[model samples]
Target: MASMLEFRTPGWNPYAVKYSPYYDSRIAVATAANYGIVGNGRVFCLGLGPQGIQVEKTFDTNDAQYDLAWSEINENQLLVACGDGSIKLYDMNVNDFPIMNFHEHKREAFSVAWSPVTKDTFASSSWDGTVKIWSPARKDSIQTLPVGNCTYSTAYCPSNPSLISAVSTDSHLRLFDLRTPASAQYHLTAKIPVHVPSPAPLPQGPSPPAVPGEILTHDWNKYNHTVIATGGVDRVIRTFDIRNPSGGPASVMMGHEYAVRRLAWSPHASDILVSASYDMTVRLWTDGSTMPAQQASPVKAGIQLGIMNRHTEFATGVDWCLFGVGGWVATVGWDERVLLWDANAMLRGQA
Candidate 1:
């Protein structure tokens, strides 16, 4: 809501944007041509400056990239997920070409996430219905967890190196434990159906059967590790506690007119989060629940803090600045624009 600093990715539609953990001013964007339906793609490394945002470096790829992850161990390195079923590791300090490449997924690699806890490993999810774990030093995937459906997002738990979470086209959120046996399907510890209907009978006219749709994105709460937020084609954002999967969503936030495409929890607040949607708007919300570890019941129907309507196309990616005063956020969309704004001012009507 603050006066936004905007930059456009010429001829490309951005898919994912991530702020570097080691550098608060640096951000990376994964993008594709023609909204990734066909054609090539690029990854842009950008920097925030007094003049606005500027491109620091750019890399071109034969296939569109759907997602990217900054290296947890090396500030100069990052990984990109490609439509060609490959993951490429690039070092910003070196030449433009990737220094390492891994091709194991049989379909487009949709998401990539570096381990926040281990700092040496990363994971990727693919349309091939598999999530693979990797280390940059290794030439092959260390492990693969089959989810039996197209997986759109995968990430390592920030608090536990041995744990990972993923959302798939199966409309389920799954948890895997690396400590378990590595077999045909890795250790799937939990699976929560995202669109299950209420157990209580409906009160009025014919109740529409529950509609199950693909979960496009999800993120773990940085302050409360047990809490996970998921959004999808249903246009509903729901938070769940992994420790009590049977209890359904702890909180549900609704307002998006179209499918929710991306979400990120505020690094500074346990209850604050932001979402981007195909409706062409970015929204901020409070999950309306105290940390389950700290309280017994969660407040339902979270509050919408504000909405930013600057994007003209589907908003695909969103990330929070880890070092800011806690209101700054970066969002990229199919409109080919990346906009940085301060959510604190947006919520207070001061921007």
Candidate 2:
């Protein structure tokens, strides 16, 4: 039987959920009132116990919180990206207020990511069309890489602190190498078109021309350092190898009936991933790169494994727990509900 737990935020809608890198029982959620249109935001530090999920701490913000990231070095500290272009660092041990505020972006800060390798620096992407690199000890950003469009997600390469990637409304995935000289175009080394024409034409008629769409979320594969997955307004998920991005997507997974809101590559498996969508469901998928011949298909390079449809509103955020047996997952949505479940149990034939 599958085990599941839930917690409701009452009036606030959660935009993102991140599991604590240090504690299995702890997680943080970024939320906004009135579905992030125009209201105050709240960040919740929640604890899981025998009694269930409980709020351990809460920080209210003057603007909507779109995304957050847990500090890799300090378990008690986390960062929140706000609608007002401010990024705030909160210390769980503190009472009622953020410990540090880093305001630089001229537009809404859409995403925040802590460097898994450096453990000291973090990055934030914004509607300002740039991704800024910063340190918790600094008052201003260390570097800003311009995306020229609304950059929705940004993450540092887990294996290389010098490498960072970001996706934007321009339907492009850009890779920046901080090791490159500043004169070399802001350290931007590669720009891969996220939407590419399908290799094969449909049987009945010609395949529709590929159209660019806004990319909302992306995540680097933990085990596969050169691989990254992207999802967006097109309702399709695509994976590409940073080394050979011109060769086109290594795999494509299509199933979501609405735009894909967020995606997370599993920490424990190279081929497994989970996605949350506006369709109000969280779906599991395998990239088919590691599947056996009979299990993989040419038309569908990646296949959906299962679906969890308990959310009553747009399923915006989903994340995998870094602890335990590795299948425990946490998801949050516009329904103001957070659901924790064992994903391994939902797999088609897994025992």
Candidate 3:
């Protein structure tokens, strides 16, 4: 209750929010006007104060911003994934213009993530069906991996800078290891489908037709390096282990009434994650893995800890504060509001 804070973003609908790794109270948001279909966008830097959330800086862009990532090596810099198929690097200390820009994708850049282990590098996924790796010092993308489908989210392993993961419109999760040679198709090491393959001995009833949907979001477990959670149009959250794909989802949780748009695993707990959905609610969950593939029906047993439904429009983004006791989270929605609340309090019915 008391731990919650809210700020209204004027004339913009936020698509993503990220807490600064260097400062617990400093946050950045990527937002678009007219709900991203058209019109310009903006990036906002904010600070949490005793009175409320205060605007620290703002940068306006010619196109909508779909996502953003903070630089791990520089406190003043961040990268924006843009609707114009470009990535713009901005320095908070500089003027409104971006200090660096990389353009190659043929369509909108949907996601951008800073490498956790390698501070100098970052990756961006796009509607152009490709993922490109870049460094702040370089003018062009250092590497490119084609997915052949619109990629919605991308992440770097917290423990291994060489390992990367992406989820796309094909509903498949792909892992690429940069350590391997580019000749090896950019080290596309693993691929896992989002749906669960039917168990041995099909049920007695008639088999149902398959439903195709897009995977809109995914995140790597910060503590458990091999664990990956994915969500999408199916409205199911499934966890997978990169070591095994034939075994199917290690766990599955179903509660969202609409597509999940974005998600983040808690920095404090590997099994805990928070999801924002088009259904206008943000829900917390325990990934419910009973020691990997050893458990039977792990997903059926996964628990939904709590749900936050204060937003009046689609909830599009969520992030956890990495510096504190770790329950602190920030969520942004189409209602043009950013919410800061304690996840633990939501679980206790206090927020």
Candidate 4:
């Protein structure tokens, strides 16, 4: 049911938004958590202490990070899926260069995630509507992921290596159980009832059917494996219990004025989460079930959450360090600045 395909080339750096692994505060014991701003081709790392930014290293890469993941393989290895349909694996261990790279997509790779269950295993989804499970040892998609739309983002369920959650541009979130056998063991079959609902009548004359929206981005709680969050261009962010993505969202966090761009859950705490948006704002969400009643559903909740006004431009990337002393959150933007925030500050301010 699986095969291997191999090739060798330099990794891609399309967006250059790779986040550093859970980094230790002690510089001597750290590999230096960094993010590369692709537009300017500048690589950024922490400046030490609480405020201010610094440049740890710089490299000339001509691409952007359409999708990226921090590898646990080593402190220095980072993988980035670029807009050019190329995947670049960088090894700071190799003089700040990509030690392994290849083209894995026919279109811009929109989302990627590193497998927490396997050392070298990872997966990627793209505008091509095809999701792939990859390992350095394989020749092609290990278990060619089956989906009906373009995947905007994907996250691996760290607790269960076999499960992956992806959001498509079609406004739907999907979960793939890779452990389920590709053949008959986990096959999907459904039968429609005899009373089929009439399709919506076409407008006026004989026009083509309108295309539907797709799911966008998603993440899983590291503390609780059952909960996953998804965002879409429809201007909504949804939290779904993988057991039932459709039954209803467990809790909806809303605040972006436009399409939600990215979502990240703190590895250190389950109740804490941060989101970025094209609306030029970053908002934090909590487990407290106090969202407004009218905005309780996915239809309204995506636009009701509170907004955090720290960044001054479109936020392209957001991440937090679980192992750091202060457990700081960082956001990079089109403004060419990477701002770091102390999550505790906002928590205490509200108190």
* Leading candidate by TM-score: 2
The best candidate by lDDT is: 2
lDDT of 4: 0.56
Candidate 4 Cα outliers beyond 4 Å, as residue runs: 1-19, 25-52, 137-141, 184-214, 289-306, 325-327
User: lDDT of each model, Cα atoms only?
Assistant: 0.89, 0.91, 0.87, 0.56
What lDDT is obtained when candidate 2 is compared to the true structure? 0.91
lDDT of 4 by residue, 156-228 (tens): 7888777776667565666677656676523222211111111322122222112334445567877778877
Query: What tens-digit string does per-residue lDDT give for candidate 1 at 1-351?
Result: 547889999899999999999988999999999999999989999998887888899988999999999998899888999999999999998777999999999999999999998788899999999999998998799988999899999988879998899999988999999898876556988899888764443232222235889899999999999999999998888888999877777777888999999999999999999999999999999987663332333326677889998999999999999996988899999999999889998889855
Pairs that collide, model 3: 252-299
For candidate 3, the TM-score is 0.94
* Candidate 1 minimal-lDDT segment of 10 residues: 200-209
Give the backbone clash total of model 4. Answer: 21
Instruction: TM-score for candidate 1, please give it.
Output: 0.94
Query: Per-residue alpha-carbon lDDT of model 3 for 81-172, expressed as tens digits?
Result: 99999999999999889999999999999999999886989999999899999988887999898888999999999899998899999989
Arrange candidates by lDDT, descending. Answer: 2, 1, 3, 4
How do all models score by TM-score?
Answer: 0.94, 0.95, 0.94, 0.75
lDDT tens digits by residue: candidate 2, 52-108: 999999999999999999999899999999999999999999988888899999999
